[model samples]
Target: MTARDEIPLRDADQVMRLSRMGSFHQSRLSFMRILLRRMRNENWQFDAPDWHVNENGVGRAVYTVHGPSRAYSLVAFAHDLPDEMRSDRVIATAWDTTFTLFDGIPTDDDIARLAQNVPLQEAGRISVRELTLSRANRSARLWDFVVANLSAGRQPDPESLKTVGYVMRTTAVYGSGKFGAADHGTIQDRPEFAAPFQAEMLTVYLIRCFVMDLLDHNAKCAGGKRAVKLSPKLRRALGIGNSTGLGMAPFLVNHPTLLHQWIAARETALARVRGIKTVTDGERDVMIHHAKSAHINAMNWHSQHPMQIAKVTELQSDMVMLCKEITRIGDAPYPWDRLYRWAAQNLTSEGLEQVVSILMEPYGDVVDDLADAMSIDESAHFYIDGTQAMGHVKSLIAKHFDWALKTDFGAGDEQARFWYVSAAKLEPRLGERDAEQGHELEQPLAIGRDVAALYRAITQDETVAHFLRKHPEHRHILRRVQMVEKFPYAEIRDNLLHAQMMPIDMLRCKLSFFGATHFDPRSDRWLRICMFQNAPFPDELYVPGNWVYPEPTGAI
Candidate 1:
């Protein structure tokens, strides 16, 4: 048996705490890396057959990716959105750019139809032929700076590029039957999209291409004959940015089975890498290079939020200590495991997670296969097992949700926050239990409180069938308890309703698996992040690439 097979996965209690989940960093198991690796291995072909934008930057572009058995196209519409109409709220009626991922290469008829409706956003309707619907706004400050500099035949200052990280930030990217788009089941069978969010990832990837093309187009329009395109190096340095808010926090709670699969794949990958008995000099060098690169990423990551600012500062310091410690470790048995143990003892949560991320970079052969197991058939766990005895259910709840059962929801502080959907926007919003009008309409996001309630109600020994027959209100929570019994890493062991709960933690956990970086939380409820920020573009996928954290900007 392999050393990895002998090493057990980390306990759910340790892995699923909100604080630790919030500190998660992207690893080889991240969906973005998995998608890119597959595309590269399969030798997918890409092309932009249409690019028709005017001097005013109002036009359409189509980027298509042709896999072995199918093709998908990103149809983008650029608008002359005045500064006043540009807002990030879902209620906003207009945006600088809108996009839809077409099931295949779109025709002139499809583009015309989309041009009329895609720009309308939520107000407009998309057909089932669309796989994903999305929109973005240019980074007003950096967009002009980059365009002006490139128009003047010079590259924008790299420091400014690093500060912003991406020229355009997406407001939303909807998939899985949202807004009339083709449901995930339509294309889930394709090998290219067997993993979760592959279509969404592909949409964002093509959107990055469109953003770059649009920037260059506008720069040339402004500079005329003197305009220069962004340098290849500078271009690759930019990624697609996203603004995520409370609407995403519920996803983790609502999709526990899938969550377990994702966390399991990553933790399993870490254990596999940790179990390596010895590392060659070449492997050590690769790990060192990635470590240095991650340090560069830490140095460049800028955030205005106070908590994130402190994290960035601590991470920068941690990287320095990491460099010093890397030199001290000598050739020995289970060297990778030894390093992990050292990190657990010496590094901050943020820094330790970063350490775990880089460690997996050099062992792709050991961990890449875990990507295939990250998707789950959630429906398989949907039906409640009525045969389970009440005592057995209580035991399962006590084991998986001991933290939940301990929460004192009677205290106002413990139930200070409530999640509800906004009537104006119909999206998730966090409201104060004491001050907001919607506390009575709260969603069942307070899983911990509900579990505690269930524990109290099931004081006597009876079958789950009897309890459910008497009180159907507890059925949902009962199903969850039964499900968690099998899926170890399924529950977030924090009080979501607590006044101190950071919804950003939930957002960060999900985004980390998407391979995002430069998490700049604007508020506790929402944050900004960059995707594929040092990743290779579709055109560059054919070339040997090292698009990992802390890219090798010559100065670094």
Candidate 2:
């Protein structure tokens, strides 16, 4: 296929806007969805060769996954962790479980070597025989309840799930050459995992299966080994839990080119649908299906945080309104194009964007093609081509990102804060310069303030190259400015240091793309989200690609 044939031609302004990116929801183009697509297309087979979890759920287990080109294994090390040690905090030294993705079945010596380092997380460096590395902790309150209820030969109250959904929450799921695994460069060519972030998703998916096994085994071990397995429907409702904190905030800023690629692909997919001048009766049916599915999913979404609850409720109301308007023009020609116009004009940010997310579902042919090209040549677009004059650079910024320029960083509250990497866990944390300490080693994530600084410096420059020679340190921000000039949606529009900054919004933007549903906020700074809840299991890849946004009954 030619360059034009690869991705749809989208407006640079629309794709580059950060607020739009921050507002993004998951679509068929998400990493997890595409990875599942590739996995199923390959007809990957999974086998459980070693299942030795004792009745107490403290034992060893191994799952063998057979891909077309390679055989991989998930070697799990489960242990008895005291209540004090089972913390989800980044500062915690231990977890209820640790697992590694081996290239193939390991020898006894290999297993022994891994057991030494996998649990150490950041403290220990793993060597490169591994593909992905991760660790998880049990939900403190829910784990004991499941054990107690099952030990009494009774099914745990399924409603108990309505609160803290998953039994285990993964502290971190690392891949792409993390610790000692093969860096993405070495393994990106593997057809099974070429799509961005697929390895991480697969690791979590397999972990979900392992957790179910552990729960059932413990019930059997405590009760009479006659404990009933959870119904497939309830199992389908469960998801791999993720306790995301500021650990994820920096990634969106650090990987500019990759961020640009993700938003670019999404915008391109939407543009293709909006430009569609015709739709058959069958195509109209698909669009309506997506609309209703989205409405139900939004309605069924649950969260305790009032802010998130309000956002979801608004989305539900908006989805209903959208569904009503959608039927009015169902028989019209180019139905999807009209629907796009209506949504853009009427729906709010959460609702309109979510509709765009769902619309991509009905046209998998388009979404699948765009989703195929996930990896990006980020370095290729890294440098600021100095050929353009100072005026030209500033002009693009002013025209495309006037909102960022309007931010008043001079105010105490606006620039009063800083983001730091914690020494204990090496995770990101936000702090106030006046109210708290640690402003000395602030991370380079405050893009709005810095980009404005670079903008003023460039305006007074004699030449673009001369400007860089005098201020080489601002090279990173310069590249980002140049990139945002082309891909407008790449940066967040809001000031990060402002008192009203909702970090949860930032987390929601990324989680929604992982096909996460229930966004229960533990606090403004951190939240709990459920991933792969309604998603098809590894065994169901044989079914269809349109199983992502399941019906309300199916969507957890």
TM-score winner:
1
Q: How accurate locally, in lDDT, is each candidate? A: 0.88, 0.74
Clashing pairs in 2: 15-489, 16-487, 16-488, 16-489, 16-490, 17-488, 17-489, 18-491, 55-221, 177-183
Candidate 2 regions exceeding 4 Å error are: 1-22, 146-157, 386-388, 459-461, 544-546, 552-556
Give the lDDT of residue 315 in candidate 2. Answer: 88
lDDT of 1 by residue, 1-556 (tens): 2345346778999889898999998888888988999999998898854888899999988998898888999999999988988788777889999999999888899999999899988888999899999999988899999999999999899888988899999999999998888888877888878888999999998899999999899999999999999998889999998999988999999999999999999888888888888777888877777788888889888999999999999999998888777767788787778888899898899999898888888888888888999998788899998877888888888888898877779998999999999998788999999987978888888899988889889978888888899989898898889989889888898899889999999999999999999999999989999999878887788776477575554522
My TM-score estimates for the predictions, one after another, are 0.97, 0.91
**Reference-based lDDT, residue 18, model 2:** 40
Tens digits of per-residue lDDT for model 2, 230-307:
666566666778888888877777886676667667777887776666666676666667778778667667788887
Highest lDDT: which candidate?
1
